[model samples]
Target chain A: MAQPLPPLSRRRLLRGLLAAAAVTALPSPGGLARAAEPLTRELPGTGEALPRVGLGSWITFNVGDDPVLREECTAVMAAFFAAGGRLIDSSPMYGSSQATIGHALERLEAVDRVYAADKVWTSSPAEGPAQIEASRQAWGVPRFDLLQVHNLLGWEGHLETLQAMKAAGEVRHLGITTSHGRRHEEVERIMRRVPLDCVQLTYNIVDREAESRLLPLARERGIGVIANRPFQRKRLIRRLAGKPLPPWAAEINTTTWAQFILKFIISHPAITCAIPATTRVDHVRENLAAAREPLPDDAMRRRMADHVRGL
Target chain B: MGGGAWWSYRPEDLLMFSPRVYARLFELHNQALWPAQLLALALGGMALVVLLRPGPRGTRLVAMLLAVAWAFVAWAFLWQRYAPIHWGIAYVIPLFGLQALLLVALGSLGGGLRLPGHWSVRRGLALGLFAYALALHPLTALATGRGLSGAEVIGLTPDPLAMATLGLAAAAEPARRAWLLLLIPVLWCLLSWLTLDTLGDRRAWLPLLAVIVALAARLWPRAPSPG
Candidate 1:
């Protein structure tokens, strides 16, 4: 008969075995693979196939004017498109990033392949329409694909205008966003009660709190989701330093850790796409590769979690 | 992290360091390296003078100079990455070779690096310099703050570079002897880097002194000194 064991040790042994099995059976490189024709998932009440990855304009295109900066933004847009990117997220709070994007779109002349997503960064419901209109005017896009109230800025009133814009065919989708782990319950309630097209929030390999609720809610509601701050502001960069990408990661075509982490974030069935903010053209291309392959299954996800956690 | 905090291109970066500072530093050096500074100057001076020595000593000095040269190169090139998060380790002394070598050279000349036959002074004077350098960082930062080159640091604080230089110099043998002669001043300049970048305010770094000392004691346990 097996000797009696303490309960804590038994739990530990089981967790260890489960982790081992998961790592051992990680899918070959084909995991984290995206569709051949730039696969996209449909937004709620909408049939459009959004590209599985977008670009967040937090620190990237936010720097206004500086002609050279505009040129670099254009290159990033071009590189983004080259890598099958479609959705680009921007907001007024980001200091003329939307305006800069408008400048870039005109220069690239490639707005046709883009999804314009901007947010109203104010709290007054009365000014909501004007704010949305300003963003629309700032970007010079005839109709925004999605308009969100950044960080729940306008609460219900901004959402009302976004809803109206959607109904009027002025905007394709009404979405909202929050970050730094705030407003999770609020985001969840919105997903549950209202009709929404997209939701943006921070989700990186380091912060998996969304895995418990928000991501699952998006799937249940059929709302498209976009991940922001997917890098945790370079923490992952330091964590992976001098460490080679796992051989198994090559199965998903990961040449670098950016693709590796992005793949991990987007691999979960709930994550419609991830919008990583990058200033470099090369970085955008690397980020785009996250959309390329089948995500690591539950087991590989655990391994990825373990790897980053230890680092 | 003298990556030195996100300056969106401010003119003050250049203007912040007044010409007076340069003049003052030169004057201070002329009056002679403060005890610690003198110690650093002696080691630095000896290292340079060794280049004029005959044969093997000169060759060794040349090798040491070349080694220090690469350290500076590595500081500027290979390890210049700044991502805010790693600022703790990145700005802490060895984060850059110019800073590290400067400390090491000073440390060797200071009294901390006493060899078996060399004189060893009590630690009081060096400790005082360490405390004074530690206190002056915020004052220096204030001077640089008047003009905004846009360097927005989360905060700045003194780091343990002085203590580290002292500990390392105290632990090496012939090298320790040379370093101890420079220790007081080396310790001061190393702490000076904290003012240059506040050095993480990573209080958790205290344990690092124990780690560095432990590593150095193991690696350079007192070797017999030659005359």
Candidate 2:
């Protein structure tokens, strides 16, 4: 009952395939050129290589009508794009964040350069379309690169709507999300039965419960995985503050404790990206820097996790 | 929501805005209300002056002024400013509206005649709270390393206004009526304390302290009203 897919959607799909082919032509993962370049991982469905570090707009970007804070948010976005970051994620539930991101995108004129991801969060199936449209208007984007049902709220109806949107080429990708270690069984069930481009869940140094099941499930399903709460909403970072970075952190090229923790999460083979929200331009750059070359290998990852566990 | 699910949420999880945004809301509110802030300060001063004498007319005047403040804040801050960012505030807005109506009823219907009078510990505590809401609340910005631009004015920002309400309600003629009037302000103070505390702001204590003082003012005896 839906119209045929649009030419723009077809072109984007072709572009993704070409980009994936280009990545395949690049040097081996361990080659010097690849190591020196910024870290990126391919989306399982589209083969689009998204930078492993994405911006999250939770408390960080919900500055409402405060011009000073809006300008500060814009600066953070500008820095994010300059650092080769893409895939800025937000939800309608976060007050004014969608508008804030729209404000920044309009000011920076980097809408075309960034990957816009937002969520549909409402209980009524009837309200889902209106809310998603409102979110797109708030972002000033023609379409969202990805849309998810937040926390599995109204997932049944919203997922059906998102599937139609994807089929109609109204959205590039569709998914579901949960955070703070919530509703995992439902999320796992959705991933098993329904097709999803990505599954976002809490996966930080301390909140590794996702590792036991969700991460492995994502890998098994060939689903792209986005790690949210990479800093456990900054509680982990605050706890690790003033603690020395491990001496061997030099091997993964980590300087600050933020980069050390971030690198540890991204180093996992299944993690497509980690969205760490920030209000500071310096912190955004520092977060992106975590995605750079010489990410910790399997053995180092174990040591890194154990060290933080002991700390 | 069943079982332990409710306990899993931390305070910060429910707080959508940062302290910076919260503080700036007051600053922007103060800026928009401009010279009106001086009028609000003057009303607070008037309430303090009238509380000292405690005549029937004075009691009604205090109630009338407080009613006006509740109406203004309900519209200006809660509805126009806060509800946009916090949909939860929409529910609180009607409570404020109800508070305004209650104060109006107390003032016009002579219910204020029941307000407590005479020099007692209750009266003294009331005076202290009224004076603090009027003069001291704004000065708190300085202690927090912020400028006057972000200062919360009486009747304009909720905290000081709530504190002042508790202060004025201390004199309610019928002790029962005093409790009725103190209900909203006391609840608002507790909610404010939780919000500020979650933001890690030290001033979170001010509302709690005000609540304690206001409670003492109501419950503490007044020298047996002297024969």
Candidates' chain A TM-scores:
0.85, 0.88
CA-RMSD of model 1 = 20.3
Error of 2 at A69 (Å): 1.1
- The interface RMSD values of the models, given in order, are 16.3, 3.5
Model 2's TM-score against the true structure: 0.90
Q: A174-275, model 2: which lDDT tens digit per residue?
A: 899988888787788898999899999888877887888889999999899899989878889999999998899999888998998899889899999999
TM-score of chain B of 1: 0.24
> Which candidate should be chosen as best, given lDDT against the real structure?
2
lDDT of 2 by residue, B124-207 (tens): 788888899889999898776768998989999888999999888865657767787899999999999999899898899999
Shift in Å, residue B165, candidate 2: 0.5
My TM-score estimates for the predictions, one after another, are 0.53, 0.90
Docking outcome class, model 1: incorrect
- Provide candidate 2's TM-score on chain A: 0.88
Worst 10 residues of 2 chain A by lDDT: A18-27
Candidate 1, A1-311: lDDT as tens digits: 99986667654554444334323322245642333235576665588777777888765665434455666677777677656678999886665578778887765565787889888877788987887788888787888888887888767888887787777888878888877566788888888888888888878788777888988888888887788878765556867878887777776667888888888888878777888877787687667666765668889888888877776
